[model samples]
Target chain A: MVYDVSKLTDFHYSALKEISNIGIGNAATSLATMLGSEVKVMTPDLKVARIEEVAEFSGGADKLVSGVLMKLSGCVKGYMVMLLPPESAKLICNTITKEQDSDIKNPMNESLISEVGHILGSTYMTAFSDFLKIDVFASAPFHTYDMIGAIMDNILIQMSQEVEHAIILDTLFTLKGNDMHGKLLTLFDPISLELILEQVNALFR
Target chain B: MIVIGMADYAVTRSPEKLTTLGLGSCVGIALYDPVTKIGGLIHIMLPTIENARFTDNCAKFADSGIPYLIEQMIGIGAVRRRLVAKIAGGAKMFSFNSDASMNIGERNIQATKVVLSEMKVPIISEDVGKNYGRTVVLDTDTGVYYVKSAIKGENVI
Candidate 1:
């Protein structure tokens, strides 16, 4: 069985959400350490949606944001994305640079944002692999500042070619005492979800 | 106003508008018949459907989408001979030095042009191919295409 989205039961859904919760918790810790601020993460929201509707789930299609994308390889396959509003990107850059005004478009700050995204991606993936007892690695980060829909179309295109539905694990992280927030999204290939479900099933039975 | 999502297409008549949002690597094709005041728009994600593992959605590929849009327009009382095209989007949002396959934006643009020409649809204007995202609106009354971007301001083509 290919273990498509339609095949996932309530148990599978809850298991997936639990995995996301643990993964995002670890990611929040990494972000808190990096910024020297307390970070709060929402319980990750899991959705099985068509590729076209994903932009709306992230926020809105026209919303301007900085998106960092990383490809996953090895045992798990899919993509990890860090989506930050321009204000959040600027705030993160300013926090690190100790500057009142930091432009996210600047090359230096762009790289900084990319590295932050990389840290979040890797940390989240680490927690996921550890919990699932699987092996996976994220590639170097690719960063772009654009509309959320534009930023994700590339990945959506790849996914659409293979499956009609995508499993999205969306986690929102907020910086304490700051109005800035960002989202980390984990999209797993259909086959990878099957492998993950197998691990989840093994743990219970 | 009707909004067309990624890998989708829509057609409308005069006094109406069609739009597609946040087009990064995807290309939006707009076709209009001036006399009938009918227009159609399609947001396509890939160049061709020939190699795609899932070929069910014709609106997802440029080679299939333009023709499909034209057919829809014709079904809705549009003259194929009088249809003109205006295109937008297909931007390389991020640069990664990998391979040609990674440059999907460029390939999408090329395929759109080829398909448009193949159908004898004259492309009057186009705003495409840069490291930015675009949102496009097509007005059926005047057959005008409005391209909006975040950093680059707005332009009507």
Candidate 2:
């Protein structure tokens, strides 16, 4: 049997990967400057999966915090989830903490997942804005456990339709003299994908 | 708008309100007794029953945040018997997987209700459950709540 891979084109995928690179790079530069520390941002590993597959992708991970960004560019809008691993979480809180962050969970300290969300979202929005030469703004980020998993649940029960694939834009930031490592993520849904494709086609033409 | 961090709590008096936006499955519970008009809102993220995540404070735990909010309301002369409770958020977000990681919202709602009932606090109004996100606002000025859905219309939750 043959399968159809007609959801997105190879050129479009490549364009998305390249865009993620540039947008994440811009975010890294901005975040590094704000922290007054050395930041080494590395290229991200890309994944393209239908929003439904996110459940399968995550398997059964525990309730860890995720920094999510919801954005709308033209007609595309979905969330970009940045899962801040526990180790990276500590490193980030320590950077901002006047002293060592407690072993206990501190609501006062911002979750690393969201701190990167602010960084990456702002960065990506700026880059995309520069590309489209239009302005886009994301809402103030809030920290929540099981954010992606919960979102998936909401999608399945409420929309009851596949949310299409997400072009997973993942990047890593090494900051604070190389002691901090966190992921920068940008998830583009189908609506946003179409607009992005249109922009790419316009640019090439 | 007051941002009540995890494992944290905040209380408000008359003429002061607390609000937070973009609650994805987290629970935003408010407490007040109309007679005194002393109200408080506590937004909690995790269930934290066993404290594996280390959020043990009553102000941080739903079981605890609810009590603390009620106590504060009572302390300010709001009678516990007359206190009315309002709740919003706790949407079953990301429901693709039926696992511990994905059930936090439901868990938060269940846990909040359990604590409230045991404390004999009646939930006067509630806006809970759904796939959408919510922004919850508590008007300490009037002891009223307004919940806005990220995907749909706004209502009192």
Candidate 3:
């Protein structure tokens, strides 16, 4: 049977959102620790959207941002992305490098951004896997600064080959009550969603 | 201005414009007939539609999308022989993955060239294949293509 993400029950969505909240909460804690400041996190938003429309859903298609991507493997297969506006990216870079102004385009800072995304993705994944009792691993991160649509179209293209729709979990976080904020987005393939739902269902059983 | 989303295409006449945003690995094809001031644009994600599971969206692939755009332009009073092409936005945004398939940007550009040649459409200009993303606009008034990038500034092809 053709798998459809829209067919997912509300219970499944709530469970999924809860898992995302826990995972992103852990990730936020890590970021807060690194920044030596409090981090504010919003409740994760979950949706099933068309692959072509995901860029706009994340933010604006033409909006310039820094994107860090990681591939998911093991029991689940998909991707995790961290999107930061230019200002946020600069703030993070300046804070980490302890410079008044640091260029995010510099190779050193670019790797720094990639490492930050790795931390968020792995921390979030660890909490998620622990909560669901599933084994999943996130690969090394890839970082780029470009238009949101440009940064995402490659992954969307790959996903479109298999499925027309995706389950997206988005969590927003802010640092030190400043304008420094970013988004953590997770895209899980339908087959992987089934695996995740199976674990969620096992709890009720 | 007519905005074409990913895996979509549009055809229009003079004084109108077509634009697609944030093209990374995807290629945007602009076909224009100078005589009629008729133009068409397509944002294609894949190299070809063959062996693809989802074939419903012909605009998603170079092989089918170019032909489909040509047909649309012809339907909108464009002469096939007078049609010239200007292309942009097939960028390898990141180099983390070394897999041959992950080099899709290069593949998309190649496939677009092949298909345009097969359809007898001469490519007048192109701004493609780099590590930066580009947003492209096709101005039907003068049959000029504008390519814009965040880091690389803007270029007219």
Candidate 4:
């Protein structure tokens, strides 16, 4: 069956949105507890876009950002990317290491950021698995700091090889009373997306 | 400056630089003719068009994109004999999976070389096959390729 994004109904959209909300909500709770500060994760903005359009989606391709990417497998397979501008990355690193008096400039801070990515990926995956009643797992996170266009190109190539379009789930994270912000982008492979739609349709039946 | 997006290609003359960024498994093919100061860059995603259901975008595959880019350069007054190619990107960003599909970077590089060879275009330089992403910029005036990476800093080829 050919996967068509335009054929997706409002029910499918709402179901996916609800799932994303639940997953981010769970991640925020865990993140808040770990950092000893309130974390706010907003509902995701989901859309289907062409590969070329994605480079300009969050900002531009030249926008500098750091990304933690994880490959997902099992019932559904795809890539989940957590993106942060340099300042937002520094903010998260500082918040995570505040009690230890650690500095973002330290070399160890990169590993610290990876750890945060791991936690966030794991939390998000766990919630998705629990809600969907399916077995899904994410590989260890890989970190890269570069032009957002490049980071997105890597994932987009892999995706475009299979399909010309991607379902982009864009979510934002912020720490309460602070100016920190991070973006989480989840890209579902077309096959997995079809399975997801079927599963969602079954729920309605 | 002309920016080539993913699965796109463009040809330009001197005083105009062409650039493409974040090449993980995709390959960026840069062809330049020193005589005319004409340059072309193609950001290709897959290795071949054999399996592609659609081939409308010639810049999306190595086999078709390379030849198509060369033709464009020729159309813009770049002599075929004076053209030299410098390629970059094609890095394996993920390590956990050893699947054949995961080795796309190597395959893309190989396919690119084959196509360039068939087209009789000499590959003068290349920076490829690593675990890091790269951003490549081609200077049409000097026919020089600049490659930048997060881990390795920068290199001019």
Winner by DockQ: 3
Worst 10 residues of 2 chain A by lDDT: A153-162
Query: Where is the poorest 10-residue window by lDDT in model 1 chain A?
Result: A1-10
What DockQ does candidate 1 score?
0.84
Candidate 4 has which clashing residue pairs, if any? A150-B22
CAPRI rating of model 3 = high
Best by TM-score: 3
TM-scores of the models, in the order given: 0.97, 0.51, 0.98, 0.90
* DockQ sort, best first: 3, 1, 4, 2
Report residue A143 deviation for candidate 3 (angstroms). 0.9
Each model's TM-score for chain A is 0.97, 0.77, 0.97, 0.92
Instruction: Order the candidate numbers by lDDT, best to worst.
Output: 3, 1, 4, 2
Could you tell me the lDDT of residue B121 within candidate 4?
91
Query: What local distance difference test score does each model get?
Result: 0.91, 0.62, 0.92, 0.82
Residue A6, candidate 4: how far off, in angstroms? Answer: 1.3
Select the stronger candidate by TM-score from 1 and 2.
1
Question: Compared with the true structure, what per-residue lDDT tens digits does model 3 show for residues A91-190?
Answer: 9999888999989999999999999999999999999999999999999999999999999998898899888888899999999686799999999888
The DockQ value obtained for model 4 is 0.46
lDDT of 2 by residue, B28-146 (tens): 78887676677778866555546333333455457767877777766767788887788887876543335765566788788888888988988989988775667667887787898
